[model samples]
Structure formats: C-alpha cells, structure tokens
Target: MRELRILVATAEAERLRGVLVMAAAQVALGGQATVFLQLDAVGLLRPPIEAPRDGAHQAAGLPSLAMVIDEALGSGVAILACQSGLALCGMSAEDLPAGVEVGGPIGFLQQTDDDARLLFA
Candidate 1:
C-alpha cells in the first residue's frame, strides 16, 4: 500500500479545512495517509469553534474537515499532535480526540521511512 504523510503548520481555520479535505481524498483513493499536525495546527483538533482568523471559515462549519479526520482515523491515517504543541498549548493527551495519537520525534521518524510520500503544508 502507498503511504502518504502530511505535515501541517498553519493555525488558520481555512487551511485546516483544506488539509483535512486533501487527507480524505488520499484515503478515499486507497492510499495510506498520515497527518502530522504540528505547531499551531493542533488547534484544529480543538472543539469546533469560530474561525481562528478573520475571513477564514470554521472547520466546524465545514463538515468535510471532521468527516475526513474521522475517516482517516478509521482507515489508519495516523493523525498525530506534536508533543511540544500540546505542552505549548497547555494541553494533554486527554484533550485530544478519540483515536488521535500523541507523539513527537519518534512518530515523525516513521514518516521519513522509505516508501512514504511526504507533504508539508
């Protein structure tokens, strides 16, 4: 199976929606996709709220984002929240969504393995 890895660093809500949409697309195409939500991107996993910035759409308003995240999780997308991000935000493992894995260096290493496709957004 093809492995797809994505690194997202944006905290803006619109980008998060796009990221989720793309991830879902890859999963739908039958490729194994992993999303590493780092930096401020981990904010995407927070309870749905207003857009993080002006002119940005809320991920909650766009059902595709949550749906894709759920789909990716069910299909083994390996969604990860950066450890530093959690600490920086004063969040813990319990703050994340069900099935979302918490990791930092080690998880990132896995994505760099051969046969994996990587994308940074």
Candidate 2:
C-alpha cells in the first residue's frame, strides 16, 4: 500500500474498540499511523487501569487502550489528544504520554488528507 497514514476519530465506546483494532493492525503491518482522539475518546489515555470498558463496571480482559497505544507507539504510530476534548474532560497535556501531543481541530485535518486513509469511529 502507499505507506498507510491513518487517522481515527472516536468518542464512543464501541467505536473506540473497533478503532483500536484497526490501529493495532496498521501498526503490525508497518503502516505510518496517527490516531487523533477527540471528544470522549480523549479519556482513553488516562492511567489505563482506570480506563472504562464499554461504559460498565466490569473489567475488560482484552488489552487496555494504553497497551494498544504503547504498541502503536513502539511501532512508530503517533497518538494525539484533542485539546478541546481534554479541556472538556478536565485533562491536560501533563496527563498524557510523552508521545501524545495536544491538537485541536487541526487534529482532524491531520487524520484526513489526500494521501491519508481516514476512518471515523
């Protein structure tokens, strides 16, 4: 493929689940990837242990979002946290990973472009 550059946007639980899977696949396949988490999706980077799963009290056995992020980063994928969403969630840049940056609406632009393969989750 054209050295895949992917951007996934999601704030929904189910959508995030699917997007995570795709991100993992892309990284595993050696694609150049970036995930722009906006809205509630910004909560994903929170200290993973407290990460919610499908919005329930039950513990999800699947690898946490943080693990997926670490894996993606290990494979050279970039993860960005939306500035607006972080403010809405009461989060800050200090709370995110060193690899994650604060991006605004421009985050969306990074996710979708002429050569980028974009997916909105």
Candidate 3:
C-alpha cells in the first residue's frame, strides 16, 4: 500500500476533519499515513482540543474531531506538528497530546517516500 502524507495548514474545522478522516481510512487499509499539522492547524491539537463544528458533527451522529484524532492515533496514524507552527500559536510541544510529534516542514517532507501521496488541507 502507498503512504499517505497530508499537510494540514489551516485551522478550519471542516478541512481538518477531512484530513483526519482520510488519514484514518488510509491506516485501516493497511497503508502508512502521516498528518503534518502546520501553521494555524497546530493550535487544534492543544489541550482541550477545540475543534469547531464538533457539536454539529455530534448532532449528525458522526464522531467528533477529537474522537477521530484519537482513533487515528490508536490505529497508528502518525501526526506531526510543525515546530514553528507551535511557536506561532504560542504553544509548546508539551501543549500537545503524547502521540503528536514536533518537527519542521523540511523534516516532514524528507520523510516522505517516493510513492507517497501528498496532500494539503
């Protein structure tokens, strides 16, 4: 299976949810998946994990963004937060959950395999 590399640069609720769902799907299929949260997106991972539209999702009988993130992590989906993004959001590595990694864009890109499908959200 091919690797799925997703670059999440926005804090938009809908888009971030999509990225997480996609990453989880990829992992369920026995593929490797990594989600790189950059820019404003890094703030979403901060404790309390405020994902906008979470209530709407719950109303629609869908899993909330936080639940999706947990499922993804439990399923072995790798999630990275950009070091600069954390600083930009006034956050530190300790602000994020245990499974999320802290790194830069260059390092994230360097880890991508030739056959990986890269996406930006």
Q: For residues 24-81, what per-residue lDDT tens digits would candidate 1 score against the true structure?
A: 6777788777778896778777765335342333433545456556766776667889
Per-residue CA lDDT of model 2 for 3-99, tens digit only, reads 3434445555455556656776776776666677886778766664244563342344566555656666776767778888898888888999778
Runs of candidate 2 with Cα error greater than 4 angstroms are: 3-10, 52-62, 107-112
Q: What would the TM-score be for candidate 2 when compared with the true structure?
A: 0.73
Least accurate 10 contiguous residues by lDDT in model 2: 49-58
In candidate 3 the C-alpha lDDT for residue 55 amounts to 92
Best by lDDT: 3
How do all models score by TM-score?
A: 0.77, 0.73, 0.95
TM-score of 1: 0.77
Q: Where is the poorest 10-residue window by lDDT in model 1?
A: 51-60
Arranged by TM-score with the best first, the candidates are: 3, 1, 2
Q: Candidate 3's residue-wise lDDT over 1-121, tens digit each? A: 8899999988886887898888999989989999999988898887887677889889999998888888889999999999989999999998888798999999998999789999988
**Residue 98, candidate 1: alpha-carbon lDDT:** 89
What are the RMSDs of all candidates, in order? 3.4, 3.5, 1.0
Candidate with more favorable, higher TM-score: 1 or 3:
3
Query: Clashes in model 3: which pairs?
Result: none
